[model samples]
Target: RHGMRLDAADQAWHLSTPTPYDPPLTYGGWNQCRALGMRIASLLDAREQESNAGSGHSDNGTKRKKKKHKVVIHTSPFLRCLQTSVAISAGMAQFEAPKDRTSSSRPRTPSQMHSASPKLPLGSQKRYRKTKLRVDAFLGEWLNPQYFDHITPPPPSSMMVATAKAELLQTEEVDTFTPTTTQRTSGGSLWNGANNRAGSSRESPLDDWSHVTNALLHAPIARRDRSNSASSVGSNESSGRKSPFRPKSPFRHGHGFQPLTSTMPKVEASTYYPPQPHYAISNSDTIPRGYISHARVNTVNVDYHWDSSRHLQEWGDGGQFGEEWSSMHRRFRRGLNGVMEWYSQHGSEERGEDALGLEQVMTHESTDDDDQEDLVVIMVTHGAGCNALIGALTNQPVLMDVGMASLTMAVRKE
Candidate 1:
């Protein structure tokens, strides 16, 4: 459960609230979420210690079993949920060291040996392997397009690509500007210095670099066109066709040429300096594949909460004063069942078994002297969904308030 936080403006609108803007989590909400995560980790630690004390020691008191703790975190795609997961992960990490924290007696790698030290520092060479956090996009607010639109096409122009790269590479300065409608629609403005219909140019000052380079490259091509036209006129004058050497603009759209857009602040250059030559191919073009071809694809299934039911007009107004609550409850239970099935399947695959009960799959404990294992699953979700789930699990209506970032614990007892 997320802690106490104000709703986003969009959420407020859906709820018919007066506020029009989404509000971020208050300072208290943020702190509460962090504290809850830390508390959960502490409680788990104490429980593990108690279990070990009761089961691990032998009668002779000469031998004791060892244990390990593992935490698996799952988060909804919502920003608040993701933030909560981060807070929880930080809390859990504070209690444990990396599995490879021990240093070798002697340097294992040649690079380490080359250094003056004969042994690596503790935790210096250790690779801390924690369970990968899973983002359940399906768990996002229902009917939100953000989670569904997984494939976003890149900008079409090379100029835009270069500008984006420059922005990424030069973080010390802001090198990008919001693109105008003309820049997005008309490809010709990039090649020529012609102003759009607005009569004002929004080009970035960095475009001066590209303009100087292009002018130099175009000069030679213009000259060659002139020479060819002069020679062709004598032979083709009788045909009455336009001259080929008329020196037309070579920076046509779809010619594989990318125009540079202005983004950075203006810099003065010497008038006497020769204009820089523009290269035929841009850095983006040199890449082996197009943006769409190299787009990454991820297959994930998320389970959103029933609070998303608010999106349905029929479910609004407290689901017609609790009359529609049963429908909402059913939806939530179905989604939760799907999640449990997935966990069961995943556990089976890992253990090479046919299937495992949800409790057995989610809860892990180890008693081996060389290995200690504990598994914790943290789920971040909406208030309505959290309350409903707790009610179903405990077989009663939720009596406690579920605030933003608030936490509820359920431990399976053997």
Candidate 2:
């Protein structure tokens, strides 16, 4: 998934997803999930060895080898989760396959490829069973009853028409810049006006609003960042290493701060409040007098009616955007507690059975009565869900945040 932004009225908010539009994983997201799956498989294999080492001796002093366990994979019903499970399975399969021990310089022939399979690690004749991944809807993102009336079915395909529109907007440029008066009032009115005009019954208007907002506000930021980076940097004359300073201007490339120029439109301080000073410029020792710094700000303007449906919360102090801090904290805490309760009862059991079955299948033997296996649960969900879960588990408030397609892992030892 990639990053996206929503625009309503004159205010815009940014959102990140595993896919550009929704419901699907981007190529990067897919690869990251796949690699994570492989890593999990490797960890399981290592754990299996530890289990074997602990139980290698019988009561009568005879040596016996333990079987490798089976892997049971469960995923959320979301399209991205399903896709991630598939990638992970592929990674596990690749991990299970024996590697060629020949030198990297040597090219393997068909005969070499068809040579007798390598002996099992423990001199056993059993083959590892493939991991079976299952999709479960209950393990999905935390759904607030106040927000959604019922569970929505997954879209037929993750591919979105809006994705095409977004791409088109990325390539298209808007030359006509209409300067509007920036009032001191909280930007909530911008979204309120749009929602009032569009009506609550309509969905198309909201989609259009988000699309147009992305095009008008988001696209420009992306384009400007890309352009500034390309323009500020050039190849070094002697050594090939990237030079820290640029030749044309002393300012760092893509720093988001630009020198005030005659060509740029003048801002009326009476009408517009320039954004808070960025730390980079504010902390600098030698300040340039004529330079004006531009800091990227995401202004979320959600309709009052859809407050329950929206997942965005006021972060940190919450005073920055005039959002109610207590309300957001309560909501987060409730959602997290609910998820933790569900996971403790169901998620733990499913993961244990699946992982044990995988071990048994791979080693072609049942687990010993005394052998306890470590369980690994991989959950794919939204940012809020992830944050809440982590906070609950760590017994701390949510402080760290993850980006789109980011992987977070937790382990439980027996």
Candidate 3:
């Protein structure tokens, strides 16, 4: 009942024997995520009120700027995870929607530009502008052949991208109009063309994401081709095998369904290799049957500015055949570091004005007087991945099985 969005019989079948097809969240999962989103909103609302009450007066004799509460959602590119984010965004929107602001009721701070409505009908749901959700490859489920009886074929980047938009379109009135050249070009170049300053002293994991994000947003198949060609050129001269290490995909997973290359013995071109997963996904494939239409495309509400690098993927050379426990720790540590960087940039008053588009950034210097508000980051991933993230942040293993749509918080005190 809590797994994939399949019929009771099919769901049971999948539970016993997992399928290769990427499944969307169950109806129950959607509702759970929305409730979780509301809880988060309530927590943030309380914190904001407390912060406002604590500040007495400004030393400058002038009114202080009102702080705008910001929430950024980073989610796995998997169908279920993306759907979870959409539902969470909807929940937050519903919670924050002002109730009778025109009357005597106290107005909700960080007012919503969207109309106040408890439930948004499908195909007409308005976009929740206050929260920005991004699909992050690093947050994807652990991908190693040894974990399962059969390796799950990774979904194509385009299909994942398309499926995300389709889900948003049905549940949240996303812009389904054709994308402009600027919108497409901007997203594509940010990742493929950005410089990776891995060696720089001040460099953060954020610098390595432009390429991966670009692939996620636009021309992923093309990027795959380029990556393959580049790898071929750098093949080991002695053995004539592609280099096990690829700078673009420092980690084994996340970059779509391209052939994997490692120090392990390579399968002969003539030898038949069983399709690792029960089914193989190609560029022409669509979302699982009965899922939303994978035709819509939205670039506005989903930010592509800061995606995680393939370097942070769950498995790689660090963890031979599969991802070792230590590799999982390192993976989440790097992911946490990158997320902290995102939090810092977003929390700062100097965040790029362009990046604040559509997001509510209330800062009235006239009547408002408060310090900067705290920023909230919602990360969507698998249950075990949740444990890994908790392990990374807390430096202790709770060894508990994380439930579906469960929220585990780690507050940063500075």
lDDT of each: 0.43, 0.40, 0.53
The true-versus-predicted C-alpha distance at residue 300 of model 3, in Å, is 8.2
The TM-score obtained by model 2 is 0.37
TM-score per prediction, in order, is 0.41, 0.37, 0.51
lDDT of 3: 0.53
lDDT of 1 by residue, 272-374 (tens): 1211223332321211221111111110111112121233111121122122445545544555555555554553114222135443444333334555554
Q: Report the C-alpha displacement of residue 200, candidate 1, in angstroms.
A: 48
Candidates sorted by lDDT, best first: 3, 1, 2
Which prediction has the highest TM-score against the true structure?
3
Top candidate, metric lDDT: 3
After superposition, which runs of candidate 2 have C-alpha atoms over 4 Å from their true positions?
Answer: 1-21, 58-67, 96-128, 142-376, 403-407
User: Poorest 10 consecutive residues of model 2 by lDDT?
Assistant: 295-304
For every candidate structure, what is the RMSD over all alpha carbons to the true structure, in angstroms?
19.7, 25.2, 24.0
Model 2 lDDT tens row, 1-414: 111112111121113323322344444454555567567668777777666767767899977666455454544445455455555654554465334477646787989879846654333443333444433333344333332232232222112222322221232222222434433323332333433322222222222244444464545322234245443343342346565664433122312223433434443221112232233332212212211111001111111111111122111111112224344445445544544444556532233324455543543444455545433445555555566556756767785666755556666434
